[model samples]
Target: MIRRKDTRRMAKRPTKPTKSVEPRRAGRGPSPEKTAQTRRVIIDAALGEFLENGYADTTMDGVARRAGVAKGTSYRYFPAKEALFEAVVREKIAGALIDADPANRRPDEPVSTFIRRTMLVSIREIERNGRAAIARLVLVEGARFPEMTEIYRRAMFEPLLKQIRDLAATARARGELRRPELEDYPHLLIAPIWFAIIHNGLLDRAHPLDIGDLFEAHLDLVFDA
Candidate 1:
C-alpha cells in the first residue's frame, strides 16, 4: 500500500515526437494530357503560321507566338520548321490515307467501290476540314521549300500512291480493272483530286469545282462503270 515508494510509476515518461510528413508536390514535367494538348496547340499554330506566311516566312518563333507558348516550348515539340510541317502533314493529311488504304477493302468490294466509299468521302470533306488549304500551301510553297515538298510527298503522296498501286493490282486480278495503266501510273487515280484542288484553289476561285464530283466522274471513266 506504499504507492509513494514507487517513483517509476509516479513519474510520467516523455512521449516521442512524431515525424512530420512533407506535402507531395506534383511532378515538374507536364502530364500526358497536358503534353498532348500543348502539342496540338503548337501544331495548330504552326499550320496557321505556315498557311498565312508560307513556309519560307514562317518561323518557329512566329509559331510559338501564335500558339501563345514560349518559343522553347515549340522547339521541344518540333525541332525545326520542316519537322513541324511534317507533323502537320502526318496528323492532318495522312489520316485520310488510312480511309483509302487498300488493306481496308473487303474481299468482294470492287476497288472503285471501295474508293468511292472511302477516298471519295474524304475528298468531299477535304475543303471543309482545311485539308485543301494545306494542299494549296504545299503547292504554292513546295518549290521554294523542297524539304517541305519532300515531307509531304513522303508522308501523304508515297503511301497513298503505293496503296493505289496495290489496289490496281487487286482490281486487275479481280477483273474490276481492264487496263494495266493504273499499276504503271498510280497518279492517274489521284489526278482529278489534284486538278480539283488546283482549279478550286487557284485557277477559278470564283467558280470552284466540287472535288468529290470530279473524283467520282473520274472514277466512272477509269472503272468504265
Candidate 2:
C-alpha cells in the first residue's frame, strides 16, 4: 500500500490539546442547593449593597464580592446589573407578598385581627428591608427599566389584591363591613396602610397624623364594630 507524501506529512503534524474541564464547584457546574444558596447570598448581599451604593454605582463584581462568590457566579445567576437589581426587588421586596395570602388567616380569627396582622407583617417587611429606600429604588429603577414594574405587579400586587378583594366581599356578605360600597374597591381598603408605608419611606418621620389613629379610622370607616 502506497500513500501520498502529502498524507504522510499531514499524519505527522501535531494536534492542539483539548481545553481542561473546570471543577464542578468552580462555576463549571454547581449543585441545585449550591445554586440556590448562591442566588440567596447574591440577593441578600446585592440588596444591602444597592441600598448603600445607589443604582448607577452598583456593579456585579461588587455584589459578587459582597456575596463572597466568584464574579462569574454572580453573572451565572444574573446576566446584567439590571437583572441583579430586579432580583433584589423580587427577593427582598416583592417576596413579602406571601404573607398577604388569605390562607394565612387563622381559623375563626376576627376579620379586624386578620387585616391588622396581614398589613402589619407586610409593613414590617418593607421597613425592615429598607422601607422607603427600597420603594424608591424600585420606582427609580423601574422608571428606567419597565420590566421591574411588571415583575412587581405580577409578583406582589395581583396576589395580594385578589386576597384582599375576596376578604372584602366576605366581610360585606357577613355584614361585618360598614361600607359595603368599598368592597368593590378592595384597593381602597388597603390603600391607607400603604399610604402610611409610603409616608414613612419618603418623610422619614411621622406624617402628622398618628398612624394608629389613622388605621383605626380606616377600620371604622370600612368595618362594623
The TM-score leader among the candidates is 1
Q: Per-residue lDDT of 1-225 in model 2, one digit per residue for the tens?
A: 975577665676677999998767745576889889888999999988889987767888899899899998888889998788768776777666676666777867767778777665555455555644766666677787676667667766677788878777767666677676666776876677567755765655654334455666777766763
Off by over 4 Å in 2: 1-29, 204-217
TM-score of each: 0.84, 0.72
lDDT of 1 at 135: 87
Tens-place lDDT digits, model 1, residues 1-225: 655587888899999999999999977998899999999999898878877887889999999999999999999999988899899989988999988888899988888889999999998999887788888888997888788789988999999999999999999999988889999999998998898899988999999999999889898999883
Query: Model 2: which residue pairs collide?
Result: none
Q: How far is candidate 2 from the true structure (C-alpha RMSD, Å)?
A: 6.8
RMSD in Å for all candidates: 7.3, 6.8
Supply the TM-score for candidate 2.
0.72
**Candidate 2: worst 10 consecutive residues by lDDT?**
204-213
Error of 1 at 4 (Å): 62
